[model samples]
Target: MKVLNKGLKFAPTKKIDKFGVFVDLQKFKRSLCLKKYFLKDPVTRQVLGENDGWRHTELKKKSHFYPKHLISKEITTFETMVLDEMEKIQPMRSQNLTKEEKEALKELAEDTTITIKPADKGGGIVILNREDYDEESLRILNDRDVYQRIPYNPTEEIKKKFDKYIQKGENNEFLNEKETDYLTVKYPKIPVFYHLPKVHKNLNKPPGRPIVSGIDSISSKVAEYLDHLLQPIVRKIPSYLKDTGDIIRSLNTITWEENFLLVTCDVRSLYTNIPHNRGCEAIKTMLLEDGEIKKEQIDYIVEGIALIL
Candidate 1:
């Protein structure tokens, strides 16, 4: 099936529209009302019991139900509460901002000459000249070795190929009918490429950490399925550490020598540097060596990975 329209192109929003903010506010208010209902009785000012029929009934209705006593004043109270909370916290802070600071932030948001993006590593924002941002992004994208300049959109072509592959898989019994349907892309989107400035690395001319948003992309479901299949094999790797916490846990199990020196290394452009054929072969080798996956399943997994790559 055709997923995305031929003319569909991604355009990033520069500012939050009023309607979007209003919708968010309404959702927040509904959440607050639901929290109040579940945590405490709005009318009786007491905690609700687990088996409360009234609460369960209201929940089953799936409506934002409020007590009769709060029906009149609840909205006004929620608005006031939201305003007060917003006053106390900025987007990245729990502390209150001064009037001048708030005004400055409002001005910053409205400014079109600059772009604000979060740092790649730090929990901080980087404000860059829009021209510089575009120039840097272009520099990265123009690298002939990494990125190829496409003359035209290939979304439809890719979608057709993917659909054909899935159909073939179902016909050959590599995938069941249900699996074929589940893997089919309903609303595929071209992945949006953006980058976060690595401020910690260099403040003056921060290098950008490339990011490709894969939400609703043609291979998103296949990627997710492959990830699920590979996760067990990944976890079994000896050097695998899930996160910083995992590293710490692993470190604690070691008996440290006084003379030992710890060394750490970072791979430069790891993802972009890896040749697609080699990467796929590496995965295929790992799965084969593991002996847990069948040959047909391994082929399926590799094919999915190739589609994603």
Candidate 2:
């Protein structure tokens, strides 16, 4: 089975359109037939009850049965409630726009496609110069020189390393249509859509920290797998503190005095603002210095981390 689709873009909206929507029905059926199956197989029912998360609820209750009609109606009702809440919470675009302001927007949008903007009093129709915006953005980036987004083209070395571990039928267990149907019916996959992220400042009064968002261009499962491999290496680092518990242990012996200077410094946008290439180099250096982790493992892990950057 082909595991990784090379040309696959991590766009949930496009993927959903290309494939189809997800709907769960098997879980409902299982719930409905709980009593029927339990009566037939006592041992199997007992095992299931032990494994299942529910503590007090009897697995053989006919009254607890879930039917398609009832479940579907409940789901629909919940969805309606959600929609109503959303409508109540989020004000519609152009909701409070005056007649004159709307007319002005209409006149401005006559020549080109325009999205509905906020109904603020200060002119709803402000035309943007794309070229100017791009130039200014580039200038700001160049001036800061904080970090650069690297192109993630998987090199041959990296690909070979990944291919070595990811063999046929090892981790790449392709689900059959029947299995897929059952799984999808139990836990449906929801398509996640990307939206324009708001660029904002952290509330540090002296010097506000500029923060930007990154597009999640990689599959979450792939990222999680990489994270698991990297965990051991991260744990090996002695200087770095992992959690609050570690910090507490480290500071346990310290005694406060009249002349003692205590300080807490927060890193502003540490992850995203760090230089990607430099970070990869640092990881490689750390691994090489460790002398315990094999060179092959270090190279593979470094390459995987670099690929994500």
Whole-model Cα lDDT per candidate? 0.72, 0.44
- Residue pairs with clashing backbones, model 2: none
lDDT of 1 by residue, 1-309 (tens): 001222433334344354666678777766666676667744454432233211101111134454434333767677677666656654343245566766877898899998888778746667888887888899889889888999999989989878887786666565554456677887799899999888777888887888889887888766765676788799998988999999999999989999989999999989888999999999999988988767776787798788878
Give candidate 2's root-mean-square deviation (CA, Å): 14.5
Instruction: Predict model 2's lDDT versus the native.
Output: 0.44
Q: After superposition, how far is residue 28 of candidate 2 from its true place, in Å?
A: 5.6
Give lDDT tens digits, candidate 2, residues 12-71: 221122112112334434464564555565554343214422111121112444434434
- TM-scores for all predictions: 0.68, 0.36
